[model samples]
Target: MSWTGRFLSFARDERVILVSIGLATFGLVSTMITALTMIRDDNEIPPAEPKTQYITQDTEDSLQLDTLEKLLDHPNFSIKEIAVKILCDRAANDPEVITYIWFGITRPDYEERMDSLRTLAVLTSQTGNEGLARLHDEKAYSALVRCMELCMQSTELPVVTDIHWDEYYLRDMGERFCLMFLTELINKYGATMLVKAKFVEKWLAKQAWGNTPEERRRNFKDYMDYRNNRITDIVNRIKHSRRGLRALEKAGLIDKESSRRRIRELPDLLMEVEEEIAAGEQSGEQQSRRTREHSAEEQRLRRQHREAMVLNDGTRPLGREDIIERDASPA
Candidate 1:
C-alpha cells in the first residue's frame, strides 16, 4: 500500500487517536489564549511566595547568622545579589551578617560589593543593633557614613507598608547606626583615621547628615550652631587632659578655638606641605648652581687680583737701599 493509504488505515481503527489529537489541540489553543490574557494583564504576577519576616528573637538570630555565613561563599556576583535579596526580603536582623558585610568592603572583590554594603546599611538602621560600631575599615566606614548621610536628608514620610508603619523606627535605627559608626570610628581609630582618610572633615563641614546639597543648605546654619555646641561638649569631655585635645587635633576631625589650629585643613594643609618640599628641592638645586657660580666668580677674581699683584711687582721699583746693596755686592 502507499504510505498515505497505510496511514489512513492505521488511524481508521483508532478513535482514541482522534480524541487525543483533538484534546491536545484544544490544550494548546487554551494555553495560547491564557498566555495572551496574561500578557495583556498589567497586574498579573505569578503569585509571590508569601514572605515571612522574622519577628521573634530566635528566628532573627538564626537568619542573621545564616546570612553572615552566606557572605563568605558569595564571591560570585550573582550569588551575592541573590543573598542580599533574600536577606532584605526577610527583613531579618543578623549582627553577624552586618559584620560580614562591613568586612566584605575590605575584600579585593568589593568592586561588586556595594549591594551588600547598602543592605547592611539598611539592616543596621532597621534593627538598631549598636554593634555596627565595631566596623573600622576606612572605606567601609565611609560607605556607611555616606548612606546615613543620605537617609537623614530624606524628607518624605516613611512608606507605609503591610510590614512597616512607623517611619521613625527605621529612621531612629539609621540614625543610631550612623552615630554608632562614627562613634566607633572615634572610639577605635580615634577619628584620626577619618581625618587621614579625609572623609570626616569634608562631610562635617559641608554635607548634611545626608550628602544632598539641598539638605545641607537647609540644615547648614543649624548644623553650624549644633557643631559649636558639640565642640563645647567635646572640650568639656576632654577638660581634664591636654591629651584629649591632642587626639582630636591628630585626627584632624575637630575644629574649634583650641582644636581649630590643630585640625589640618584638607587641600591646603596637604598641598602646602607637598609644595614646601618641592620648593625646598628646587631651592637646593638653585643654591647649588649659585654656589658653583659664586665659586667660579671668586676664582676668577682671585686670579685677576694675583695677576694685578704680579703686574704691580713688575711695574714698581725696588727700595733704593736694596738696589744699591745688590749692585755693590755684585761689584
Candidate 2:
C-alpha cells in the first residue's frame, strides 16, 4: 500500500499515537521560534543601561564604542551626548579616555574644542567621585588652566594676530567653554578657582616667557606697555576680551553692570577680583594660624598634666593613648 493508505489502514490505537506525535512536533517547533523572536527583540532594542559595552569592531553594529570615541566632537549634538554618556558610565575610570577628552578640549579646532569641553563639563558633573579623582590630576588641571588662559582675562595682555588663526578663536572658546569650566568646577565641584586663576596669571606673566626674575618682570612689563593703547588694538580682539570679562562676571568673581562695556572699565573689575582673592587668602591664613595656636596650647597642657601626674605617683606618667594601649596588652 502507499504510505498514506497505510496510515488510514492502521488500528485505532495506532492512529491515536500518530496524531499525538504530530502535535508534539508542532509544539516543539513553535517554542523554538518564539524563543528566537524574543532574542532578536532584545538585541534590536535600546539597553536598560546608560552605557552599553562597546560592540566589537567585527560586529555589524554601526555604533561601536571605539567609533563613538572618535566622534566625541561630532557636529550632531545628540551623537556626542550619547558617546559621552556611554564613556562616563562604562569607562568612567579609564585614564586614556580622560586624556582624550581633555586634549580634545584644547585642540586647535575652535568649534571642536568647544564641543569637547561642553561634553567634558557634563561628564565631570555626572561621574561624581571619578571626576573628583581627576580633579587632583595636576596634568589635567594644567591643561584646563592653559585653556582658561586663552580667555583674554587681562586685556592688556596681548592680541591674537596669527593670520591663519581665527581672530576670535580664544574669545569664542572663552565664551562657550573655558569660563564655564571655572564656574562649573567651583560651583558644582567645589574647586578652588582662585588658585587656578593665580596659576594662570603667573604662567603668563613670568613662567611662560622669561628667564631670570628681572627678565621675566621686563617681559610682562613690555607686554603691558604694548597693550597700553587699547583703542589702537583691533576691535575684534577687544570684543573677545569682553567675552572673557562676561565669563568672569558669570563666575561671580566679578560684579559689573551691563552699562559698562568699555575696555577701560575692565581694569577696575580685575582689581576687584584681585582684592577678593587676596582677602580670601588672608582670611585663610588667619584661620590656619588660630588652629595652629590652639593645637600647640592643647599639646602644652597635656605635657604639663603628664609631668604633674608623674611627680605625684613617683613614676613616669604615660600619655592617655599610651596608658590605654598598656592596659589593653596581655600582662
Candidate 3:
C-alpha cells in the first residue's frame, strides 16, 4: 500500500491519528522559526569558544545515506551533531532523505521523535551554510504543509458503526506529539518561540470550539444521537438474548455459544451509555468559553515565549551565539 493509504487508515481511527494535520503543521512552524531562521545580530549572540572542532573537508556525503540517517538518533550528542551537520550539507536537499526523516518521526516513539528534533535544532545553529539550510527548510515545510492539506481534504470521518467517536485521540496527539516534542528544544534552551507560539494560537482557534461553537454543538448532538442508538441496540440485545436463545433451541438442538461474550461486553456498553447520559448536550456558552480559553492560552504562551528571551538568554534570541551559550550552560 502507498503512504497515502497507510496514512488514511491511521487518520480514520478514533484511538490514533498518524502525523495529524494540526500537529504536523505545528511542527513545521516550529522548525521554520527556530530551526531554519538564522540569527544575524551579533549583539543578541555573544561570541563563545567553539567546543566542537569544525570539519575541514566536506565530508557531507561521505557516509552512506542510510547510515547517516541512523546517526540522528545515536546515543551520543557528538555523533548526532556530526550526523546533523553532514545531512544539513548534502542530504538536506534529497527527497528520499527528507521522507526518511519524516517517516522516522511519525512513529509512536517519543525518544525517537525528540532525537530527530534535536538533530534539526543542531542544524539550525550550525554556521556557514545558510543557503543549504534554507533549501532544506523550504522543502521540508512545503511537503509537511501538503500532507496537512491532504488530511483536511480526506472524507474519512469514522462511520461510528465499526468505530466510536473519541476526542481522546486528538488530545493525545496534541499533548504527546505536538505540544511535547515540538516545544522540547525551545523549553530546554529557554529560547523564545514567538512565531511558533503564535502559530499554535491561530491553529487552535480554528478548532470547533473557537469559530462556530453553535454549529459544533449541533454536530456533537448528531453524534450523541448516534451514540444513543448504538447503546439502545446493545441494551436490546442483552435484554432479549434469552428469547433468541430459546428460538435457536427450537430451530435446532442449539450449538454451544459463549455466554461470557454477552456478560463481558455488557459492563462496558453500560458504562458508555451512562457516560453519554451524563454528558447530556453541549451548550453554546460552554463552547464559547472553550474558545476564549484557547485564545487566552495562546496569549499566555506568546507572553511566556516573549519573557523567556530575558530568562533563557541575557537578551532576545537572534544569533547563533545565544544557542552556543545555552548549550555550554550547566544543566
Candidate 4:
C-alpha cells in the first residue's frame, strides 16, 4: 500500500511540472513571434515623403531667371539655395541679375540673405567673370555695406539655451559670407576704392569679441591676427600693382606722372599697413602674456586650496578665508 501510493503521488507531480514547462515555453514562443512580426511590419512600411519635390538639372535649367528670382523668397531652404545657384550662374553674364540678387540682402529670411551674400560673393570674386564690372558698382557696394550693417546689428552671440539659436546661427553664417564678399572686393578694388577701406576699418572696429573676459582676450588676439594678415595681404597686393604700373609706364600705355603718383600712394598705404601690423602684433603679445599670467594665478590658487584641503586630513573643508590665512601665515 505504501509503494503504490508514493508512485502515484510522484507521477501526478511529474505531470504538473511537465504542463507548467509547456505553458512557459508556449508563452516565450508567443512573445518572440509577436516581436518578429512587429519588426517585419516596420521593415515593410514605406519611407516618409520628402518635403520638396526633387528637380533634375534639366528642369532647374529650364526655369526662367524671373521664376528663379521669385523662388528666392520661398519658405523651403533648398528652393532658395537652388534659386541662388542658378542666379549666380546667370549673374556671370547679366548685370540685371546682380540687381535681383543684391536685393535679397534685405529679405527677412536669414537663409535667403545668406544665399544672396554667397551668390554676390561668387559674382565679385577674383575667379568670377572679370567682364562683369557692374559686379563692383556702387549699388553692389551699397548692398554689401547694408549686409554688413545688418550683421553688426545682430552680432550678439547666441547660446545653446537661447530660443533663437537657429536664427542666430544662420545670421552668423550670412555675416561670414558678407565679410568674405567685402574682403574679395577690398582686395580687387581697394587700390581705387577709398570707401571700401574706410568701411572695412569701421566694420572691424565695431566687431564684438566675446561674452567673457577670457573669451574676449582670446578672440581679440585672433581678431588682431586676422586684421594683421588682411593688411599684409593688401600691402603685398599694392606692391604687385605698383610693379604692374611700372611696366605699363615703361610701355608708354600709362602716363608717367599718373603712374608715379599711384606708385607713391601704394608705398604710403604699405607703410601705414606695416605700422598697423606691427602695433597689432605688439598688442596681441601683451594680451596673450596677461592671459597666461591670469591663468597661472588661478592655477596657483586652485593648487594651494587643494593642498590646504589635504592638510586638513579630510576632517573639514577649508573655506577661502581659511586657505588665504593659512597661506599667508605659513611658509
Task: Itemize residue pairs with steric clashes in candidate 1.
Answer: 64-94, 149-209, 149-210, 150-210
**Per model, how many backbone clashes are there?**
4, 0, 0, 0
Clashes of 2: 0
lDDT tens string, model 4, 1-331?
7999987797779777899899999999999999999999988968798796677878867998678768999999977876776666655667566677888995766678878776666655523646235655666666766776676666664332222222323446666665556556545454323243234344433445445545544554444344433433433343334444554344333357766776544322233333343345446432211112246555554344434322233332221222322263232
Where is model 2 poorest over a 10-residue stretch in terms of lDDT?
A: 317-326
Residue 248, candidate 2: alpha-carbon lDDT = 35
The model with the greatest TM-score is 4
Report clash pairs, candidate 4.
none
Ranking by TM-score: 4, 2, 1, 3
TM-score against truth, every candidate: 0.27, 0.32, 0.25, 0.35
Model 3 ranges off by over 4 Å = 1-54, 59-80, 99-142, 145-206, 210-331
Mark the 10 consecutive residues where model 4 has the least summed lDDT.
285-294
lDDT of the structure predicted as candidate 3:
0.40
Better of 1 and 4 by TM-score: 4
Residue range 1-331, candidate 2, lDDT tens digits:
8988876767457778899899999999999999999999888966586766654534424567678778797999876876676667554567787778778766666666667787677777768656745655446656676665544343333343322333233344444355445443443322334344443243333223344555544443444345432211211121223344444334332345531354333332222333354446456432211112246555453343333221123132121222211122222
Which pairs clash inside model 3? none
lDDT of each: 0.44, 0.48, 0.40, 0.53
Model 1 C-alpha lDDT per residue in residues 61-162, reported as the tens digit of each score: 466646655763777976565455455534444546555675554344433344555566665554443434435555655655565445435434333222
Superposition TM-score, candidate 1 onto the true structure: 0.27
lDDT tens per residue, model 3, 1-331: 9999998987798655644767888988988777445544433667798796665565554667798879988999999987877767664556665567565444455555445544544444563445223423333433332332233233233332222564424432212333332233322222122121232223222234212444443443344345543222222232223333233223222322423343222222232322342233322121211112246555453333333222234332122222221122222
Q: Which of the predicted structures, 3 or 4, would earn the higher lDDT when compared with the native?
A: 4
Which candidate should be chosen as best, given lDDT against the real structure? 4
